[model samples]
Target: MKRITSFILLLTLIIAMVFPAPFAFAAVTQSAPTTEVPTTEVVTTEVPTTEVPTTAAPTTEAATTEVATTEVPTTEANTTEAATTEAPMMTTAAPGTTNPDTVTILHTNDMHGRLDAEDGRVIGMAKLKTIKDNVQPTLMFDSGDAFQGLPLSNFSKGADMAKAMNAVGYDAMTVGNHEFDFGYAMAMQYKQLLNFPIISSNVYKDGKSVFAPSTIIEKNGKKFGVIGVTTPETATKTHPNNILGVTFLDPVASVTAEMKKLQGQVDAFIILSHLGIDSTTKLEWRGDNLMNNLASNKDFLNNAIIVLDGHSHSVIENGQLKNTALLAQTGTALANIGKVTFDLQGKNATNITASMIKEADTKDVTQDEAVKAIVETAKANFGKATSEVVFHNPVPLQGERSDVRTRETNLGNAIADAMEAYSETGFDTAGDFAVTNGGGIRASIDGNKDVTVGDIIKVLPFGNTITQIQVKGTDVVAMFEHALSAPTIEKDGQVGLDANGAFLHISKSIKVHYDLTKPAGERVYAIEVLNKQTNKFEPLQLDKTYKVVTNDFLAVGGDGYTMLGGPREEGPSLDTVVRNYFKAADMTAYQSTELQRILAGTASENVPGEVTTETPTTEAPTVEATTETPTTEAPTDEATTETPTTEAPTDEATMVEDTIETVTTEQPTSIQDTPAASVEVKHDNVIPFDQAVKQKDKSQHDAKAQTDKETAHQLPITGEAAGTGAAAIGLFGLGLYLIKRKSA
Candidate 1:
């Protein structure tokens, strides 16, 4: 009887061991609330703005490679459906079958409408599709600046961009400043056209958000709260007319409010941000500033896994910003794709990682045919506009930022010559010589390279149209003075290259010599206009009225060229004029290929032949665009990565207890070492606005944004629990043997 009773007791103990002890259940009950986040709406409006379920209200906290080359079926009736139909990427996770804890994020930014598979260095949408399709359980996102740089996408008013993204199966995207380039209504129309979510937390109109503020996505059974935020620069960086009714609040304040709104519902936080990381931005609106402020505050990381950023077009290496490894910015033009994986469980995530895939590493990736078809169709509709060679360049023309902004280059000569050549053709206003801001030209025409409309578009991406305006000769001299007024520095030790956006380029028909030793606004000592009949240089008449061919941007006082205008007489687009000029010139470059036009008193390399200045001079051969010009390789702009400077927030908007889930971290003294060395990367296509409507003042961000910091009592890890149960079962077997032997 005693032995039987002992066996029964051992059986009861073994059964109890199969499950957690009652005290363990009590511990789980204590932590259950932390895991069961309430389901709440996040405010997605109708139409483009979806109305997400509103949360409980203010609180704190927060693919296997396969290039699907499947060709499209040729049934005309099924063509549109096949192209527009979007099958979600490998993202669905069965609760019982798969590891519901892990998910991947695939992202791109600053694509700037580089949708073509063959354009420039852009990997194109099709290749990106190949790269994206390889990973399973992934969500695709674009940080912004996706729709307005190239002609093909812009020609469709952003529809091509939407189509391509749709075919590629994007899950979500943040609004980039360039999204408003076509105008606000068109931007919203584009939003309505897309198959995924477009969100921005700070963009509000009439006291309501213009688009959705946040979206909740389910990946591998884990709920990810994706909060979208665009840079406040959008208020001024784009056409002011487009965002007239929209108001952008402080980013920190918005983030805090949203965190409070989503207190306990999400498993992780993702900031799909267009806020760039750059020093050019003031302290308040910077990513690095905000991250530095919150580096020690894990709660303020607000449970955020990563910040996929854009706008500065900078590449942040190692996915670290201000020692906070949760931030990343892939440089502009889809050069790299970013990835982040999360082994998320409640608020305790020990396995989270972020990385980027470079273009050079994409050789093994293959394209998705449907996406390829859409992109190729967009290009086909645009015609050989980007790929077909417009003209075969015999010699390289220098339109490099350093040369164009500082001194005369053969490429600048070609542009000015094109202006003059265009002026000579039939037009309402005529005469005199042509002058354009060196800033107008963006890139160089590589010698021996086949020039395409795409290349020209890249050189003059802005859609500024040309117009002839009249100004007095004295004013022209003053303009030239302003153009040459920037102080010269020794090229050897300068921290930054001297860049003058307003540096003027003159036609071959005009010559102006400058004295660098003179004061600003008084540099030009002589000016001469070409006499067509005599092909000779003559002194300019100070009182003479000279008609000039220049772009409308300058005529409207853009780039500070306000001194040269009258009634604007519009002509062909600047690009169209250049195209026309190219066709007629038969690839002819300017005869004044040297510094013959503007004799800057530099090294005795090109001494002025016509001007009798005390400056020693040698004349360069008057060579037109020839097949054998000297080779000059302009240094390319490296991928820039900047961690923006930010100031601490005035309010402790995101404060919580410093529990075990959080850790104290020492802040880095300087963030300079975080990103690549500083370099100026020009963002073109911005519409000029009145000076009063610049970027907003100041910023705010909290390091302790998440409200809940309750440290739950320790619970067994799954593996630990399994091991404990296994050990208990082994002991139970031993007890059964002992009891059976004793009873026998």
Candidate 2:
């Protein structure tokens, strides 16, 4: 039996070796099934041995299954972590397509009703249109003063200016001081004609908004907020009646309020300020000056990203203000255009660049046909009156000066002469002289040149009608005294006549000489009136009232001539007189004499001869022998050796002969005719009570004073306040940190 069992075990071992543990069990089952034995009986016999074998199978299967599960979980966990880290990065990297980083803003300031270019250095509406067409998605804005410089603007009462601007597609504009030239009603009418928005943050009427406080434009997904601030000084500089019911608020305060309101709403902020730059420091700061106060106000400086300045006619390169904000001015008369570019994101500005639109670069640019048509139509309606040259002048004339109303210019003299001539010819009474305020002349005429109608208009741009007035010589002297006494006319602490007296250009026949060293009121040394008929010079008689010719500006006492406005007798219009003079003097005979000849006079026996003469001789005989000579007897003693001698005439007979000769010699008269009438003018010198009050108020609110006050207040209390706050915060934070650290 033992031998048989061993042999059987050996066979089993061989089977196990050949089949492996898993197949050995499957083979046993197959073998059992073929024999028809119960599978349960076979499994029961092999259970303990099978369990041992399955233990190894379970270990291997468990290891393989654990590896597969671990791989899947690790891969899924890694994928989830990666997705969580990358999502925020993608969101951060993409700026929405609608972001406004590509917006451009184009602006102009102080166009001053210049529909056409002036001096060949300016850009007109046509050129402006070309620029607009070339720049896409551009918003055009005028800072202010778009009207009131030329005849075209004045005759149409700003209608033509508005139409021209509209034709060029202006997007927005602001009101300037000159807009009130014709009065607020006219300004309102002009506003009505504009197709674009008009913004004036400070100007108000009857507590109602005459114009919007600000304008918002959305272009290229970018929002631009623009606010306008007219200088408060307008109240004094412009006619008070025009702004009678209006009140001008502080520009800094107005802008600050507007900016706060616009925050989070616009991507960029712009301020159109008609406030001129300060003359003293050239820095933007708050001071008594209107422009200084506006510029220096912290609120405005901080809030505005760009300031398009006007009135002062300044140009800024690189667009920097306080090294923070961007600022620009295109000067006056369409000389240049201002351009600003901004990169914006939603309501925030990221980058900015600014440059001036130069006239040279755009000179040949095509003009807008629409604006051109409007200009042409206006011209056609006005006829030659708008374009004709009034007369020709040999010298240039200009009216601008630092402080004084008078300027030294040949043109000024010519204008005064023309006025005087006109008054004399047109008026019934003998006009003593024609006088004009130096400020009346706006430009210089090139001497001896054909003065086109355009040149005449430029020189007399105010379009003031001439008016005749009668004043005594005393009153004329008083006007001169007032001009000299005015504090504004002084320079360098010394008040005296200019070397050229260019500011006081006067006509012929009236002579004025003043002492340089004399006090303001006593400067007039002498005044002479010329008798045109007899060609005689005579001193002015203070007691006698004389008729004078002057423009309506002076007759109404414009430019601070109080004397003229006070009880001045009325006469004919200066325009009528001038027209009459031109009529009397054949237009064909109108010839411009040398400035020197007009200033001096023709040479005479008593005067030096022509400069071109080769030789000069004295015509008056030398007075060697004053006494009459006695007759000498020709050695009458003929018998004694008579000497021949001539007898001199007796004193009585010589006197009679001299008297007869003097009587026979008549004064030389020239063919040139003199006008009959004389006109005297006085300027308005009285400042209205309201204007004085406003000036006082402005002085009190000087930016320098406000800044000083702020500095003083801060110096005393800021340190203490900061110390207390810092101590309290420090204690609280210390307590919290101690508690947290202790807990940790």
CA lDDT of each candidate? 0.56, 0.48
**Model 2 misses residue 377 by how many Å?**
2.7
Write model 2 residue lDDT over 1-744, tens digit each, in one string.
544554555555455444433222221112333533111100010111111110001121122122222111122111111221111110112222334465566888767567775435668877787887777434678888787665555556668889988887777787776676555666777757887777776565544445666777765555667777775544433333345555555455455556666666666677777765533111222111333333454443433367777764555545654423566666666777778876655544546677878777785687787888887876665444544444544333433322113322344444566666655434555467767665444444454666554444444444344556778777877765654442222444533332111124455556554444545565554455666564544556777776776655445433334466433433332322332333233232223222311121211111211111111121111112112211211110111011011110000000010001111122112211112112221211211112333357668879778876566534432333445544545555555555555557
Residue-level lDDT tens digits of model 1 in 368-449: 7888888888877665435656677776666654456666666666666677666665355444677777655766777677
**Root-mean-square deviation per candidate:** 24.6, 40.7
lDDT of 1: 0.56
Native-structure RMSD, model 1: 24.6
Instruction: Estimate candidate 2's RMSD in Å.
Output: 40.7
- Tell me, by TM-score, which candidate is best: 1
Which 10 consecutive positions of candidate 2 have the poorest summed lDDT?
A: 649-658
